[model samples]
Target: MAFGRRRFLAVLSTTAAVLGLASPSAERAAAATVCPLALSVSAQVSPPGGSPYTVCSGVVPSFDGTPLDVDVSLPQDSSGPLPLMVMLNGWGHDKTDFESTTPAGNGANTYHWNNAWFTGKGFAVLNFTSRGFHRSCGKDPATGYTYATDPACAGRADWTHLADRRWEVHDTQFLAGLLVDAGVAAPDKVVTTGDSYGGGQSWLLALSQDKVMTPDGTSVPWTSPKGVPLHLAAAVPQYAWTDLAQALIDNGRGSDGLSGAPGDGPHEDPVGVAKESYLDGLYALGTEYGQYAADDPTADIPGWHARITAGEPYGKDPLINQIVRQLADYRSPYDMPVPPASVRIPVLSIQGTTDPLFPAVHTAQMVNRLQAAAPGYPVWTFYGDLGHSYADNPHQVWAAANDEANDWLDAVLAGSQPTTARTTLSTTACMPGQTNATLTADRFSRLANGSWTFTGSTGAVTTSSIPDGTEAAAVDPIANSGCRTTPAQSDRGVASWVFDPPSPGIITGSPVVHVTATPQGADAELAARLFDIDPASGTQTLITRSVYRVTGSPGNVQPLAFELWPAGWQLQSGHRLRLELTQSDAPTWRPDNETSSLTLSPPVLTVPVRTS
Candidate 1:
């Protein structure tokens, strides 16, 4: 399946009968004029029956003149034109992530993306490898090097654009055009969705304008050959980041400036530093796996290498580092100060309650912004298990979250209005088959609060190795039954508090934690955790957690405001709520260098309690 310039030219030449050909004979009559596409009927079968679909795999020219590998799935059983679905893969992954093929090459699910399910629901799914990833034509073919390693690819690597309006966003419009021209997808009626990297791209696609200036200072056409604008009928971004910089750094400001703060601020001019472990992974994806480092014979190549270096500790320069962070925020969905009224498409955002990577509060922030832009907009949010894993768990309901999303998409396709309900699927509060459960927030001012302070010696220090793998220790929040014996209360450099409710209470939203800590070192890191403790046995079950970091004066008591992972949990009558403040969690965040006696003020944990 090697497609070069000649192959792309062949596809372009065979485009005549693709649009409005009407009949098979007409298609054949014009076949000589239309370049034939390299398409095949995949063995993949649809669910609920054995319906089949055709897969067109090849390279399509993207907005930046780079060719991207694309997989177009069309149901052979379709009676007429179908709505288009463009799926974006997560970071460092290609179109293969959505495929059902296992590592051993056995096809377990038949279709990687459950394409058969969507095709059965009458959708044409376009799965394409984003530029600069997995066989995409961004690297230098002669040396097989990527932008990560080879300076030659600097001008064309798709990741260099990093979901920029001119690159990936523009490429989506171009791909949709190709589908439309081929008569496989309907124009002006496409739904875009994906998880993580792909999920974030969906928001960029919806918010982007129809004009773009390429990185090389050239203006490109953002429309199809027929001049049709890219029309996104709806979008469903799962676990996506609304603001990339904020998601990375523990900055006090929330997505909409109305959300929440990193520190309980009253202090002036504070900055949120980068999370090293996660940033390291993100940067490595471009250099190590993205491009062949071995192929580049140079020592300490620039670009990503230099950026990674700059990202290390207090960063390059205080002013410059802050500027870079601000730039990232401006480039993301946060740029949309007001949701465009033109984008009336229903948005169904799916988030993970226990995901440390991209916290659940981001979903609420997005929902608030979208609804604020258009009052009564059909925007919905569903909270499920942690991260991208689909493993079964007792704490979260992945099955129900998926079902609700499908139902919303089906309704939108049928011309129904978007659902206004915001739901969270939790086995504790709203069990499966239960009805009439509403979500509410338990305010901080409403809860009885107490303070616990643990002071470390002036020389006491904690550190962990870079690129920590401890995050995978507990994939599911409830997967680790042994957490009861973990003993978080008395750990070194940790402060603990306990809450015992007389009656059982259900938490339905993001939990806020306020900490006023006296800093001892040049920089500081604070992590907050909520634990469900058994009053009698003293066993602790971790509920959720959040991390915050800041750089400033060491003597002042810094007021930090942050939220734990948005979660829905039922605190049984005898169960006690424990709040623990820890100095560091290796692999999760970079350790603070300075050793200081930290004093914690009365820490308050405010959870959203469902009422009625």
Candidate 2:
């Protein structure tokens, strides 16, 4: 299996050669023509019956005169007059992050083929990079490149190359337009979807048909694609940053939750908005051209210390330093807020359970804004275990999520009337037959062959019991009875179960503890939290949340089972993952009894494992 270097660089340089298509003006002439993508397609099946399909690369003209590379894939069928789904990539990225193009040899992006099922279900899938990304013709000789000084980055228009701004948006809008231009899809009814940054764009396209405000707050097109629409027929946006201002706020360094100094008030001022560290680095590099050697200076750049601590050698680059500070002040929600009432189309919003950026909370914020603005309309939301883009991003969910979003869109695009349920979760959909992935209390995560761990509990413990082949050094959280010993305790609410780290490199799914307190009596619920020893502080980053709330009861010997969300935390090198148990996660979740001493048996912690 060779890495895709030719397709990457080839498309990066020459587009017409790869996609076998003409330039923009030429495309316009061919637009109304019915040259509906003369292409071949196929599929590759994963073990146990999971099949993904793909298509050869296609072409279009994105950007002003630059060539844009297109990767279109479909299901394993030659369905006719298929519904189309055209998607674009995010910053510093291309179509690969979404889906692969080919399974064997050097092929196209998969998202094209990944959507084959969607295509099989009757839809044509499309994904591509703008002229700036590989094979997409546009290139900014300044900021994006290491040796170029991007002067454009220093003004009101945001110094991104025209490729970044116009070309990318053009990439998506153009694809959808091409279908109609070439008579592939009807303009009025399109079901578009994406997660994270791409989700932002899908919302943009659904709205692209709407006549609304431009990025500059000026009103534009209502349907014919002017500066992106403010509407769509059915749009699914998952784990997306609701507002740019909130994104900068959530992305601010440190978990203190201050967004900015309290004086930073509203996000009306872009310059005074926000600034992340990288933004500053770009400025410094741009200001001090020919002064240093580096690729992109990300946060982990080792050379930063050598340059910064080496005295004020780079002191004259304060303007460069202000780049980060400037970015922090940005408040462009919906990429550029158009008022949710402005968004009259059906919307399906999904969120990730543990996405650090563009978190579930951000999605909630969007719902709040939209509901307040437009009281009666269709909106569906889902929170799942997946993260950002399924394939293309370092932090996005690609496959598991794409299907989830697509499944819902399938219902909407089919014109199913939705109930007025403000929030609809996906627990019932694809709910794998609940598998009991249990491990003895002494072990970290569950492994095959009944090997929970090498230790077990010595007495009455709440974690897991000292079962066969359990750890010898298993910890007992029951002994840790006081709140003072718990950093997360508020009024006697904290539970801890300790275990050894699994053989290094083993990442475990969320842990579910099935415990039975012989006597069940509680008004409060049990909040399950996953924590690990904080190497330095010797505590834990207690990832706590509610499992279920049980009404305080007065009974004897009742079975109680709590399923904590399957988590993905590592019992890292030199550290162990701990399960903190509590009647409730305080302040946020209040436990009724502080002194309810009940014997806990069946002390089993069920952990999901990538590699047992």
Candidate that would win on TM-score: 1
TM accuracy, model 1: 0.74
For candidate 1, which ten residues in a row score worst on lDDT? 1-10
All candidates: TM-score = 0.74, 0.48
| Per-residue lDDT over 118-142 for candidate 2, one digit per residue giving the tens place of the 0 to 100 score | 5445566676653333334323233
Candidate RMSDs in Å, in order, are 8.7, 15.7
Question: Per-residue lDDT tens digits of candidate 1, residues 266-369?
Answer: 11124454555556656665553343323321211233334433533544564445444433533467555454566566777777665555666677666666
Measured by lDDT, the strongest candidate is: 1
Off by over 4 Å in 1: 1-50, 77-80, 100-113, 138-155, 158-160, 209-222, 255-269, 285-288, 292-331, 388-396, 427-485, 535-538, 550-554, 595-597
Per-residue error (Å), model 1, residue 116: 1.8
To one decimal, what is the Cα RMSD in angstroms of model 1 from the true structure? 8.7
Model 2 misplaced regions, further than 4 Å: 1-56, 74-81, 100-113, 138-167, 206-209, 212-219, 222-231, 249-331, 334-343, 388-404, 419-539, 542-612
